[model samples]
Target: MKSVFRKILLLFITVCTLFVVLKWDLIRYGWQQARGQIAIMYNAEPLAHFLENPSYPDSLKAKIKLVEKVKTFANAELGFSSESQYEKMFDQKGKELMWVVTAALPYSLESYKWNFPVLGEVSYKGFFIEKEAIKLAQQLTKKGYDVRVRTASAWSTLGWLNDPLLSNVLNLSNGRLAELILHELTHDEIFIKDSIEFNENLASFFGQEFTKKFFKKQLERYASELYDYLLHLEDRHTLNKFVRNYLPRFDSLYQKIEGLSTIEKENQKFYLIEKFKQDLRNQKFKNPKYTDFIKSEIDVNNAFLLSYKRYSGHQELLERKLQTQFDGDIGKMLDFYQKNYDSL
Candidate 1:
């Protein structure tokens, strides 16, 4: 019996060693992510603690209260699950918490995807360490893929962990803050595997719709603010339309260059992209808020354009469904989607 037990222990140790050897990269990445998440959770303090701390500013306290109001509205009215989210806060202390990297074929709109265990396939990879994200982006660029790296304001853990409100976001205006919170809550309520575009579009649609309702409920107090926000939404809508209109043209251009050399194809791609940026700059918008945004797209590539498409592609269809099928009832639409996400 002693000899048998010793043999079994040796086999167990060997198996674990083999597993570690086989999955070192994944294990290391998982450890990095887990460590970052744990650090945030450990540093977070309950909302009450901050509210009661006299050293905390009144302005920040007001934002904290606003966060609570947004969460309550999302739960009671928009039918999103709270699940203890936003009950605590993490101070980013002026640093970005995460960076997301997206990649695409230089000559095509096809997004490069990353597969994880439970989340399945996702088009973007997130890194808690900025240098890690930049390293991946550099590697992808060397591999001839168009890559874009941007700071992420927030992301859902899909209910795996209670997400805390980051201190950096408290600088957003009330309406913008409400939109951000509602957007994340939508993810908590409904997520479909391997359908990132649909998930993001659904969240954005609900975030905008619910924010409108949230402001409309207190129109007397936020009428001007609501009006300005609506104009901002209009600018975004116009931009989405502009991008949608150009997608087919981009596809056509790519198809036209099928037989060209790689260098020639890249040249043509940038030429067209430059032309598109110029046209975008020439367009009239409802607000001047996007002037700097338009200028930033001068370096736009397939990855950047496709990233925008992921969030806005299905928005019109969702809006039509909301108005026609759900009679503009956001909650009912949410319920239908939540019940039928697998089919979607």
Candidate 2:
């Protein structure tokens, strides 16, 4: 019996060792692929492609124009932020490498057998292959979650979830790449496990706020375009509010449909979706080219997604409270968020 136990232990260790070794190669390949992909995207699109996408929502396209104007303004009039000097830091300095940019997926039967080297198991509706991400958006919509799904050739890993297998940084448009790197690095600087909502909200808040400073300093050159840039900001705020309002209704509808019979659920779901479109149409957000909510497959339980989306809305409120109580600094904010979140 003792001998058998020893053998089992030895086998377990051997398997673990093999797994680690295999993962090392995967990590290497993933980084290489990620780098290569970023280079290719940059080469093909040249940053201008995203701007020229005829399908890009006018609101967002306007934002991109602002970014360019900001860059020009900064260089010409405002005098560049010495910080922009660090822009090159996020790029692949040597050979174009490769890495995976992935997201945790809602549970599905269609699991990929492959592991992402340092990142562990690959899940469905995740962002490894971008098409799958689009599919995921559609699926999540059917499940009654409101989301705006956009694809980009570049993304960042933020410091917290450093999976060596995925891309550390991507070659993106100057404005976009900067945002991705800052956002990802913010995660690396401070991350809380199982609190993706808090993590993302903080990163997003800081990233945007910081970008405002960055662009403000950079756009000194393009004073004439500053008003146009501000318009983009106004549009973003509008869009964000729109998304927040829609999410709650979608969440309520999802809960209502969860236990219904198949036919009943379908009938109700279609009704809700048509209503949803009508709401968007009423709000002037119904861009036919961009709006697609196909009923392909629906797994009704979406507590994870609901919680994440809902939490983002509340995080700011919580953060503001913390700021009032303890002044606006990161450490205090984190403590309050963690303590409050756990208590809930």
The top-ranked prediction according to TM-score is 1
Per-residue lDDT tens digits of candidate 1, residues 248-287?
A: 8899999999999989998998889888998998877866
Which has the greatest lDDT? 1
Model 1 CA deviation exceeding 4 Å by range: 1-15, 342-344
**lDDT for each of the candidates?**
0.87, 0.46
lDDT tens digits by residue: candidate 2, 186-243: 5544455444455667766655544555555647753433444355445444445655
User: How does model 1 score by TM-score?
Assistant: 0.93
Query: Which portions of model 2 show Cα errors greater than 4 Å?
Result: 1-150, 159-181, 222-226, 284-344
